[model samples]
Target chain A: MINKLRMGAAGAVFAAALAGTPAFAADNADATATAEILESIDVTLVSGTSLDFGAMVVTGAGTVSLDASTGNLDCSDADIVCSGATDIAEFSVDTASDGRTLQINLPSSVNLLRAGGTAGNAADELVLDGFNSDAAYDAVNDEYTLVYDASGTNEFAVAGDLTFDGSEGPGVYNGTFNVSVEYN
Target chain B: MIRLAASRLSCFLACLAAAGTFGIALPVSAQGDLLVAPTRVILDGRRGTEVILSNIGSEEATYRIGIELRRMTSEGQLVEVSREEANELEQAAMRMVRYAPRRITLPPGQPQAVRLSARPAVELPDGEYRVHMSFRAIPKPQPVEEQAEQAQGIKIKLIPIYGVTIPVIIRHGRLQATVALSDPGIVTGEKQKWFQLTMQREGESSTYGEIRVMKRGNSEPVYMVRGVAIYPEVGERRVTLPLSSEQAAALKGPVRIEYREMPEAGGALIAALETAIG
Candidate 1:
């Protein structure tokens, strides 16, 4: 009888120990997940030109957004300030027929706004507009005001020269837009 | 032209600063690089473009930069492109052109290809894309064993190759969203600065989506925001949170934007965007 009583007491203690494990594990997982979530960022598009999908934008959300869902980013030589072509977050054009291409190389200087809600974690759209070349620097109000414009669509004239009557030749050409984001 | 692969405007201005014809030498480390000033091109359904290429080498070096499009696996490892299969590619990516310097011998203080070119296509979406270039010395065939022995003593033949590859980007599109800024207008006082965030997306054929952005305790955002989408759109959208007057006043030097991403294309999750806001 004494031995039975000892076994019963031990069983009760063991059951209590088991009962605490789930709560402990859940708390640990929740804490870890919260920490991870705190240190994350999300990126998405807003407005401008047309979204032809020349490049891909990644986000913290759960879904993939396609360029077709977006519009075109429009800016040209008329806007002396570097716009449209220069502020591209990312791209993949190797070079043009004439050996000219553009690229973005920043040594960690700026930050981009991101989406934090659960609505479109799937994806966010981007619009590259509000390009006014008159401003040499990125305008405080505009995100890409300082970006350079080098796309053929702007001042590039990226194909064979067209002639109304006599002009000819110099058909193939290349172009690129370069700009720097220097932070003080 | 000291370094052709560098910025055209910068180089031109530097030349003028040195009194037009007087010469300006570049740092030794800046030599033999095929630098594409603005490493990306954004087209508004347009075609034909140009950029600049230069030999940033301190000494006379030859440049035969090879440009091609390779496939990126889900793991993010680049699959070397085979020239034979280059015949098939996206239509917009067809009209590719680069400085075909059969051999560009740039002097210690000279630049070349003052103007480069590009030809854009009109039928594509707005998102991010990638392309690579190899700027190393072309490998020469090795001599036969007997040919080597026949040469003086031990025919010592060595070819030192040098190259630096760069990724080119193309962003095109329009985006509009209601940004929820922590502060309406980012204001700073007492030698302080704050950070705001934005996002851009290029087009498809891309394989990345999903990212995360966050900061330490302070004013915790109710939801988590993502910095990069495997393929974000090709436009800019604002997502800012105002820094309280107190935080701005106590600010030291820089605000940080630390982010991480898990590319659907495959590979370990890595830091996608890390910028400073001051």
Candidate 2:
């Protein structure tokens, strides 16, 4: 009986050795299979100086222009002009993947914008504050949306800098630039 | 109709440079709005919902609400979502862009319905910008009051007051945006059929604008692909853009996509792809 038990143990050891045969190559085989599947990679822009901002490629991809003066919210009494309509400069990235699939990133860098409106009171004219941008992902379209992120930012210089006197300013008095953007 | 701004107080720039025109002033009685729609909201782009603006004010006002596009490129440059050509291949999502009335006359004490959509473009690009729903109002001028003592008994200070209050809501568009890169770069006067781009301005109540394509990152775009636009109620057809060789040779960088969903809609620009000589 002891000899039979020893034989059984020897057989189990042999089976375990046989199992190791496939285990060693299993990972490699799996990797090969994965390699066969289509792969997609995205190029993220992470504020790197190594990137040459001037070095660019013009993909055949195209986008529509969404420049409209009506998006400016104003009052009927206020003589807000609609003539300052700007043409949209939408950029596209057509990958080898047929441009239909848009890949949005974390902390999407996009926002909805409203620009160039002014208000004035005796003490201080509450200008548009012009810069508090946030970002969100547009899942249906698979893209990132953002707006001007300048609120609470130190770029405006100072209240004197933020303030404008279009009446007396030259070039572009930078009149009360108040605009904000955020993601959904 | 005036396009209202995100901010409550928009300067009534007598000078015509003001792009959007709308106003901010809560209704005397907070009935439909404030209770129904918040002054502002975090609009989700996928649902393609319609934001309804009600005239909850004591008096009716005109409105021209629309979407505005803005963004920084992958290379950290400001994409022009307000250009005639595709400075970038950025698509306009959710066709949720438009004005209530290019010209409207609202009645007092009645809720007027204006819509802003949150629909994604059928062909969308990448890069996000600070996009906001902007509006402006031109409150009708009130008559100057001439204070005169009606009788010897009582005197009332007749201070003439007038206002144009516009309620705004952001409706989403179901349309989506996608990017399509041209073959390297189509030469000037060169005819190349690379791909067919689809467009839809499916907003609740907004005007549909045009689709534009220009080279991305071009400080000054040399070529443009644009034409007459339309206004639709529900499902309008799609339009195509034909590029010329001049457009191909000089169109550098990615193209910015900008368009309106409603007859006069507004939207944030989306980038499609980079373009250059192959």
Candidate 3:
């Protein structure tokens, strides 16, 4: 019985050693495997205010321009009517991923047409030309450095001029343009 | 429609020169202040999802929302694409998406939603489609100065527009992707040492997962990265992750490298490999 026990113990030890050799060898080769991970994200941006260019009256063959900085209006000599209640376009951003920098993209210009009407002539159209924005951006370089504040918010403003031809018809003019935001 | 001359903002500089203190405030280009949520979106037979845009700046802003195309390079950089360059799968993806109110104007401290829905065609081939939604700031116009400058031949407008973009993805029917880690290496260059990982993919569709490196006997990973994407553009991609000196030193022996889905989605183990480094 004693001899049998000793032989069994030797056999067990040898078996354990052999089993360990493969794991050590496996470590020598590069390890490789695959993993499947579902992807999802919860991001949302809310609009709190709308861009108000204010109300304006078109005079004769002159232009009515709005200052982006002061939100003031400048009507040319051909102007017949004018109102000075223009407001700069404003936006505020909120996100769960606070402190991440974002970039804003805006069109260089936009056109305003007489409301519910097509281009009749020069008098039927006006242009919002040359935009000066508060957001730090370089149209040439296409770069931005925008970040949310500690409270998970980032705000910006857009100001542009509204130009009318010498004889813009008397009516409300509306137009639509594009703005894009991205993580820098 | 008003025939507006789309002029750049640089024309305003000339105005400042001519009209000294003309009561017109100049454009004060400050750092961009905008917020967007869920940097990425994945829609798979789910209801419509909403992306929120908020203006965090002190002033009100108008953001024009539009869908743009971007293709991921092997190095994980997104390169913009034009409609003419879109592939068949990419084109199909665009047709399946429907978003409302392309333009949103907001005041300071206000937020707006761009609702998005995926309308896949019946019997559509199983694959992944994506589009990048962008929110850009529309600069206020400087009319009087621009026209005056145009008359004077000083047309140098510098309207700096800034915004953000996020990936909106849709998956249709029986799509599978396999992700693996290989070529584990430690590279030191430019006065920095980084742990480099080679992520490999197989099968159809794309894989978006996180990479984690943990030493033996440690429950937590020493280094981890989320939002690692292995798009269908490449079968293999090499990503370099910066590591502190201490973390690099701790990585001298055997370490377990794991690639898993986002933890929010249960972080299931897709593939794992053992890498021994010195």
Task: Compare candidates 1 and 2 on TM-score and give the better one.
Answer: 1
Candidate 3 lDDT for residue B39? 68
List the candidates' TM-scores in order.
0.32, 0.24, 0.54
Model 1, residue B253: C-alpha shift (Å)? 24
Q: Candidate 3: list runs displaced more than 4 Å.
A: A1-184, B1-32, B143-158, B244-247
Model 2 C-alpha lDDT per residue in residues B164-268, reported as the tens digit of each score? 111222334343433222333332212231212433433333232234455565433354332222222223333223333454444445554444221212334
User: Which stretches in model 2 have alpha-carbon errors above 4 Å?
Assistant: A1-184, B1-47, B72-81, B84-104, B116-131, B142-278
How far out, in Å, is residue B206 in model 2?
25
Cα displacement (angstroms), candidate 1, residue A138, comes to: 38
| Residue lDDT tens for model 2, A96-173 | 112112112222222211112233431222122222111222222333322212121111111100212222111111
Worst 10 residues of 2 chain A by lDDT: A1-10
lDDT of 1 by residue, A1-184 (tens): 0001000110111000111122223322322111000010001111121212122222121211122112233212231111222121221121211112111121111111112212222121221222222211122432221112223221111001100111111111111122221100
Model 3 residue B162 CA deviation (Å) reads: 2.1
Task: Sum up the clashes in candidate 1.
Answer: 152
Residue-level error in angstroms, candidate 3, position B54? 0.9
- Model 3, B83-198: lDDT tens digits are 89999988988888889879877765455557898999987888888888876667666464332332111111233455668888888887888887888878774444667778
